[model samples]
Target: MSRNIPLLDLQKEFEMLKPELMPALEEVLSSARFIMGPQLDELNDHIQSLLGVKHHIPCANGTDALLIALKALDIQPGDEVITTPFTFVATAETIAFAGAVPVFTDIRSDTCLMDPNLIEERITEKTKAIIPVHLFGQMVPMEPVMTIAKKYGLKVIEDTAQAIGATQHGCFAGTIGDIGTISYFPSKNLGAYGDAGGIVTNNDSLAETCALIANHGQAHKYEHHLIGLNSRMDSLQAAILNVKIKYLEEWNILRAEKAAWYHKYLDPSVETPVTVPGNTHIYHQYTIKVDQRDALKEYLAGQGIATAVHYPIPLNEQPAIAALKLHGFPTPVAAKTAQRVLSLPMNQYLSEEDIRYVADAVNSFLNTKKSQSFQNSPTGSSV
Candidate 1:
């Protein structure tokens, strides 16, 4: 019988780390450090040293990280924050959550990142920030985004939920902007056992503000500085992250190896992900653009292979965003990619054999459709 392949099999990874994780979790329980404690401090130090950032403020989730970053930057009501609509809802939702308008920008057709060329036309006097999402494990070409931001005097927030350790032109994914937000949800490249997040910045004042906003605006005990929310990552999640952080670089390398296998084995018909110049993709999702994405996903499921669509709908087209009554620029590329992008099974533990199986499944499906007229699919794969 064929084996069942999950989109991400964290259970195997968990089992591998069981010994270290158990002792760490037990220590937190025994010390009764359920909330902020030594564990969080250690994790922060670990991340700070690795990323070479001035501060790493722990938070409850990635959404809170973005919201706190926005609040710290003083994005006021009616202020516009530009971001790509092709990303997860959290990216734009956090802007609206911070009482700022989410101005949608179109994405690059090849890489699906926010197009810097389209950004200038969207900026207005009300624009305060630009959020470039590092989607599917590759950093957006941040040089142009930063240049445009500096030209417009707009703050920048890097949404690095998927591309934690990814780099563009030697700068880490989260370090290029004014502030960077990370997600430690279990599925991330550097995931915790549950919900967790952190903020990274080189500026001292912004770091202090983010820390305060994430902790109910407390400057000191019983002293309120600004209106803030209670959003701190717990000790248990921190403890889990402590053990996992050491292996992050190794795991990302392994994931890249798995992606290579797919690239080598997939048939010529399917379009593979494109990694831009001077960028390292961690392959967080290994998304490919195909004509019949839903059909391929269904066919793979029947073969005990799991696949996922990173975002089936652009945020600007969603009803919740529509309810906000916000006017968004046209995002035809985002809308077009949303229907074609399919995330194949990608994880550190995926073997070459597993990749071949998935590629074969994809090729078989495409072969079934080969007789029909094909369009808009990039080529360059050989099985």
Candidate 2:
């Protein structure tokens, strides 16, 4: 029997949470206080408690959270912020939008994380901060990154968009850095009903500045103190996220279990995700690296299985940033990785049977490719 598996299915998640979510939505609709309602405060409190942070500033989306954090840190024109080129463009886009140059850095081949070894060489007098992204629900080696930041007096902003409940050595992803950002874009580990995000910080001054900036730079209503954007979290989205946060840890566990199933069953010739020591990976996307990535993706589609590429191009090669005329740094690993990475179907709702099926399909395709290659060899002969 042919099975249809999607990369991610939000409908199943919604049906499971409908019992608890409907009332929350009804309560918000009844109150008629759509924007900046009580739900936002409730959600903020829950997130702050979850991450053990002092303050949580809710915003409209993840991109805004990054921008707000950079602006609050006073990143001025010509300043440089270091980050990896392998991640989503928003990581570098926010830096450029904040009037700072995003210094691209290479990544490690094993973990696909920003190489802490390569960061210091890019530092200059104008380098003001480091934005280490926890790509695909895994933590960057923060101990050394933090050490470097301390030596250079550079601020650290963690882009924890894909990793919410992940931890390294018992320290949470967003809590380790000076400022951290999370996304609730309906596809995140702790997704909301719509676009939503939050900023986390232990620094009282930075927290206050970010909150003010998110609320139109106001010290009081209609009193603008500094230039800022109007980026507030919607009350309805907050209500949805408040409910979803309760299950985030459990969902992450299930995701990890699913990833393990893949690790056990996948072909040994393919490369699987690597988890750093003492770190808890939430498995936002169970991505695998294989040769003939595009052909394999097409083969999977024919078998009624869905797949996706997390990123098909490195940030430095993107046309959108071409106008910035940024200097190019050698990111050979990231450049090579973009061509071979493929994300498999992953969700808490998936069963063991489903995982096995996906693995079987992938192996069947890989085996076929191997057989074809051997037959095409010059020394090959029919058995």
Candidate 3:
């Protein structure tokens, strides 16, 4: 029987951390404080120290984190927020949810990040913010984005759902922009046991606003200043994350090692991920570009090797975005990318032997396709 490898082996991760995890959970349970408890406060302090971010505000999930950010920045209806259309919908959805128009931008074919060059043309008088999504485990080139934001006098929100520890020029992903949002989705690099998220900022006012916005806009008891959402992170999720945070860097490093194995073992014909200059890629997804991506995914599935498409469609072309009646932009690269991008099994738990097995399966399929194609061509002269 073929061995089955999963895209994210969270169960294995949980087993590895269970020693500390159980004790932490016991402590949270013993304290009987579930909401914004000591565990959450401790996690906040640890995150601030670990990432060197000035302010950390915990939320229910990444989407709320983004929404909190937009509301904190006072983004109004009809305002425009420029962002790439290639990433998860939450990056764009929060903009629309905040009653702002999402201005679509193209992404770079190599890094699949919002092309800074393509951003200026999309900026309009109504443009209020630029959301640079750090797709995968890599941080987008923030300097150029920051420069553009400064020039346009627009707020910058780093959609860092997939890139928590990722850094650019030694600065953490969410800290470079005006505000950064993170998701603790189970599949993320620093994921929690349940839904958890955070907002980070260097500005004290933005920090305060985020905290208020996340907890129903009550600075003090029953003193509502602005409308807000009930998006506070619970104690149990915080306790779980606290146990996992210590291993985050180690896991990120291991993921990079696993990515290297995929490169070394896979056929050279395959297009692997490319890390942007001055960026540290945590390989949140070891995605590759290939012809007949769906076929390859199905082949891998049959081999008991799981695979995924990080995104199979661009946001601008999606039914929901279309419903907004938003003007379309030239997203040729993002559109092409949606059809070709495929993510292979990637986790710290994957061993070299596991990777080798998966790679052999991939090479076998591609090589066979090549052979068949050659044989069918007019110039074929197979033995």
Residue-level lDDT tens digits of model 2 in 57-110: 999999999999999999998999999998989999999998899999999888
Q: RMSD of each candidate?
A: 3.8, 1.0, 1.2
Clashing pairs in 1: none
Q: What is the lDDT of residue 352 in candidate 2?
A: 89
Q: How close is candidate 3 to the true structure, as a TM-score?
A: 0.98
Model 3 residue-pair collision total? 0
Candidates 1 and 3 compared: the better one by lDDT is 3
Q: Which runs of model 3 end up more than 4 angstroms from their true locations?
A: 381-383
lDDT of 3 at 244: 89
1-383: candidate 1 lDDT, tens digit per residue: 56699999899999999999999999999999798889999999998887878889999999999999999999999999999999999998989887899999899988998888999999999999999999999988888999999999999999988888898877888998999999999999899998999999999999999999989999999899989899989999999999999999999899999989999999866788889899999998999999889988998999999989989999999999989988757899999999999999998888899999999988988887773434333442221
Give the CA lDDT, 0 to 100, for residue 204 in model 2. 96
Candidate 1, which segments miss by more than 4 Å at Cα?
A: 372-383
The CA lDDT of each predicted structure is 0.91, 0.92, 0.92
| lDDT of each residue in 43-83, candidate 3, tens digit only | 98988998898899999999999999999999999999999
Instruction: Assess the local accuracy of residue 21 in candidate 3 as a C-alpha lDDT between 0 and 100.
Output: 93
Rank candidates by TM-score, best first: 2, 3, 1
